[model samples]
Target: SQQGEEDPQALSIQEGENATMNCSYKTSINNLQWYRQNSGRGLVHLILIRSNEREKHSGRLRVTLDTSKKSSSLLITASRAADTASYFCATPAIGGGSNYKLTFGKGTLLTVNP
Candidate 1:
């Protein structure tokens, strides 16, 4: 079963504006990760926040996790048109041991217009 559900199905903003996206999950997870995908392309990992971590940051991206609520959020600072893409939240499958695969959310489509 898919674990995460992202909100605001889509967002549009001018360049230089910050964009925020959120995700809510159904079950306990070992870790939560964010990914970005350009149109007609595969996804690229953005950041990962473990269940034990409350917050993490990489470059202009910030991520926060709340295991108690089974939710997480990603914030992109100083956004640019190039940052436009579909962002998704993912978690490992519930079972499958070391061979588990990632289950992704529906994704939030972000459009940064110049």
Candidate 2:
């Protein structure tokens, strides 16, 4: 079943500021991942954190997982206009037999103004 559910539905910030998005999920997950999508484009993988790990960082992005709470957060530092896009959190389905698949949240729309 689908798990991740992103918070704040939408966000707007000026360039150079920081942006933070959150996700909450139901049921246990082995790992959680974050992705970004530009308008009319496919999503890009940002970062992933395993259930065993508390936090991870990659470039300007930081991800944190709290499996005990079944929640995660993503932080983007030094946000730029190019960072304006939709962010999503994904988790693998609990059971899909041989057809393993990932389920994604509705996403948070981030608008970074120049």
Instruction: Name the top lDDT candidate.
Output: 1
For model 1, the stretches where C-alpha displacement exceeds 4 angstroms are 95-99
Off by over 4 Å in 2: none
The worst-scoring run of ten residues by lDDT in candidate 1 lies at 92-101
CA lDDT, every prediction? 0.94, 0.93
> Model 1 misses residue 14 by how many Å?
1.1
Worst 10 residues of 2 by lDDT: 92-101
Q: Write candidate 1's Cα lDDT for 67-114 as tens digits.
A: 999999999999999999999999877556667778999999999999
- Clashing pairs in model 1, backbone N/Cα/C closer than 3 A: none
